[model samples]
Target: MIENQIGKRFAEALSDSITDDDRVEEARDNLRQFCNAMEQDSQLGRFFLHPSIPEENKAALVMEFCEKISALEEVRNLMRMLVERQKMCFVKNVSAYFDEVVARRLNQARVQVVSAQPLSEDHIKKLKTMLDRVLGKSALLETRVDESLLGGLKLSVGSLVADASIKNALALLKQSIEKEEVLSEFASG
Candidate 1:
């Protein structure tokens, strides 16, 4: 809970900084990249998030890395703020929320489409077009093929999920039969 509270605070501050149209997108990308690098290099994540270290030294090291990756001033300032406050673990959460905030500002959405089989370029392009129209904003579609999905497709566009998989169909059928049985019992009562 404490971590979530701290993450929310950082996310809110970052969101506020994104009001300047010129800075939001690039800032979000840089932040995500920084967070990705941190995730990929666990040692770096541990070094920055370690509470045992002197805050100034940690902040300096993070600032140096932040400067090396991105020219976006907004991102640099955000990195400095996180490092100085020793809130570096929340960087990943902040990056995710930052993207959500920016997408909301643009009236756009980031979507993930997963399928058991690979999709052609035409399939992906058509899906993007349909989603953009349905969503009323441009869509950034991330495509993945997970064999566990077991054919059909699963689309997660913002908070809504469209499941067209056989697994979900079977689950729905099972749910419907259960509901029907319950209703029959109530009727007999």
Candidate 2:
């Protein structure tokens, strides 16, 4: 929704203003946290986003929050840019899409790993290193233990899947048999 509405435009504009890739993350994170808070709480959201609210007030509050983080100058600049452009309404989507762009630049991937058992720090570190090497980029991994997988792990990154779990193997076997049965019936007919 908001992603579709503002993602591309926000990404292009944000990328242009901010050159350092990490600053993109900082801007994105700050915008996201601020937007999320405002969205979840109606009174503040209305107060800040109301058309009647003066730009000075918005800029002051933005500076106050930005100061709390001890963040880079680029972050404050980005927030100031949003305030100046009157685009703070879309800050949430802007941050989400900006992070997506930043991730793309780093060639970073969000890998979801579901294993039959919880992974130890050693396992995660080893896996992270392996993914970075194999993928030729950084990896932001979210690992979870899904006992329903029966055994082994199932990894998914974007559209790619590396399913080594017992449950998936069994499902694959079942599908193969059903396909074979259908083929046999067609041949007989």
Candidate 3:
């Protein structure tokens, strides 16, 4: 919970620093790229997380990385601040929340749709249209196939999940049956 707050604070700070929507997007991309590098390169990750490493070295490395990625000055400052505060571990969290903040700022909703099979373009378009109407804002739909769903789709918008999958339906049915059986036993007793 504290980590989430920390991540949100940093994300908001970065988001507030940039005035242009395009610059905000660029900063987000730069942050994602930096986080990806940290995740993909174990040595680099170690360098950031290592306690004994000098702060000067870490700051220098961050600056060098920002230059390589053509990061915005705001983004560079964010990284430097994180390094100084020893919050390198929260980079991924910050990136994730940064996306959320940006989406909110742009009056967009990021919806994740998981289905048993790949959805056709027409289907996606229809779904997006429906979601846009329901959300009252443009929906940024991200679709993925998860065969375990059996059928139907699961829609995730931020913390809310609407599970219409066959697997979930089966689980709900089973729970209902169990509850009915328990109620029947009590009545008989």
- For model 2, residues 32-145, the per-residue Cα lDDT tens digits are 677776778878666666788898998898888788866567667777877877777777666777777778876888899999999999999999999999988899998998
Task: State the lDDT of candidate 3 residue by residue for 84-126, as single tens digits.
Answer: 9999889989999999999989889999999999999999999
lDDT tens per residue, model 1, 60-98: 887787778764767788788887766787888787777
What does the lDDT read for residue 142 in candidate 1? 91
In candidate 2, the residue pairs with backbone N, CA or C atoms under 3 Å apart (3 or more residues apart, or in different chains) clash, namely none
Model 3 TM: 0.85
Q: Provide TM-scores for the models.
A: 0.82, 0.73, 0.85
- Top TM-score model: 3
Q: Which stretches of candidate 1 lie over 4 Å from their true place?
A: 18-22, 170-189
Ranking by TM-score: 3, 1, 2
> Which scores better on lDDT, 1 or 3?
3
**Residue 65 in model 2: lDDT:** 79
List candidate 3 stretches off by more than 4 Å: 176-189
